[model samples]
Target: MNEKEFKKAIDHYRSLIDKEMANEKVIDGKFVGPKKLTKKDKIDLEDIIHPDRPFLSKDAPEDLDSLYVTTFRVGNLKKPEVLTKAGYGTDVIGGIEFGSNLVKTGLIESVDDIAPFLAKYKIGILDLFREEEVEDGKKLDIRVYECIDCAGMPNIGEPVCYFETGMLIGILSELTGKEVFAEELRCWTSGYSCCQFDVDIKETKKGLDG
Candidate 1:
């Protein structure tokens, strides 16, 4: 994402506080009492707290490219395997939470609307190019263009969008209520223009108690 888009995202996040707390007002020094929260409000509140870093701060870099470079240095240059695994694992939870919240808040009707949601939130451009039935469930071939993590990166001979892959898996798993797995098949770091993911979701067997 560019500086303008990043700042816009931050602004959108800041705007939520007012929207969610429309009924609340400052009492003397602090906003008093826990106001009755709707499901949407709760979702918004959850989002504000769940992120790794607070978006409320005004102090930030003009561009996020440096941050991206630093992350690459730490994850790829330092301990590649360990950092990649850790990032994927952690971001999975974040994705699940975000997907659940989006649905609950009526932000998007369902998983079919995820591509627009990603673009609206300045995450990436997601395209599900292929899908077919498998014995267990289904497989999806997805592509991500202008990925926030590694869209224009140099060739590192390995995929570096572990977080993005894990997030997609988590989102699909939560939305479909199935076991999801994903493998990064292509990446800009691997001399690709866009990122590609091979995702598989399997259906679970149920007890025939009924």
Candidate 2:
């Protein structure tokens, strides 16, 4: 499809998804931690597909980027209410872990140069940004028009994708050679049409020094 037509298609589909998402009751409380797991609990859990696997599944969509986003989102969000119950801390940790995996792929070298790489991950829809100066660091931003995490899912009232947030921080930290902290300030889950993440850097001057 032509670029104009393709954007239209995305807008139309997201319009419907936005409405459906409104029906979700946003949560205002913290995640209820899952009961501490036993070794057997971990062992007994069946090995389902990795969250990123379906992107390459035999029946996967030819549109690699979109397919990967949707599949990765759907696969991970399958039981978010149950899964996130591990607590918000888990989200950041998981984001870092997953981000580490992405780092291993070496697609994105630095936060300032993340656009093209993130586009590959999503669909050329991520906007990379750098905010004002900091006392001892800098702020990085990523604004997304179509976030897969909350695209089709019901809204839950707060930023529901710390995984992406922390992942960004971790990746940027490696790229910039600085300790980075990231947070989701807004979300589609809270009725926002887009998702924006802010990053705080520590112990480094602005710009991609790493």
| Best-fitting candidate, scored by TM-score | 2
| lDDT tens digits by residue: candidate 1, 1-210 | 445654564455335423533544444443321233222211111222222222211244654544543454344334344464555555656665666566667776677778777765545667676799988889998877656566545544455576677778767776777778887766555545556789998777232222
Alpha carbon lDDT of residue 126, candidate 1? 72
TM-score of each: 0.55, 0.59
lDDT of each: 0.57, 0.53
Number of the top lDDT candidate: 1
In model 2, where is the ten-residue run with the lowest total lDDT? Answer: 41-50
For 1-210, candidate 2 gives per-residue lDDT tens digits of 334543553465356435644544434552211122122221111221222221112234555544555556556545546554565687788778767666667766555445545444453245454476777777666655555555333334455666778777777777766778887765555445456677787875436465
Task: List residue ranges in candidate 2 displaced over 4 A.
Answer: 1-70, 77-83, 204-210
Pairs with backbone N, CA or C atoms under 3 Å apart (clashes), candidate 2: 26-156, 27-156
Q: Candidate 1: list runs displaced more than 4 Å.
A: 1-88, 205-210
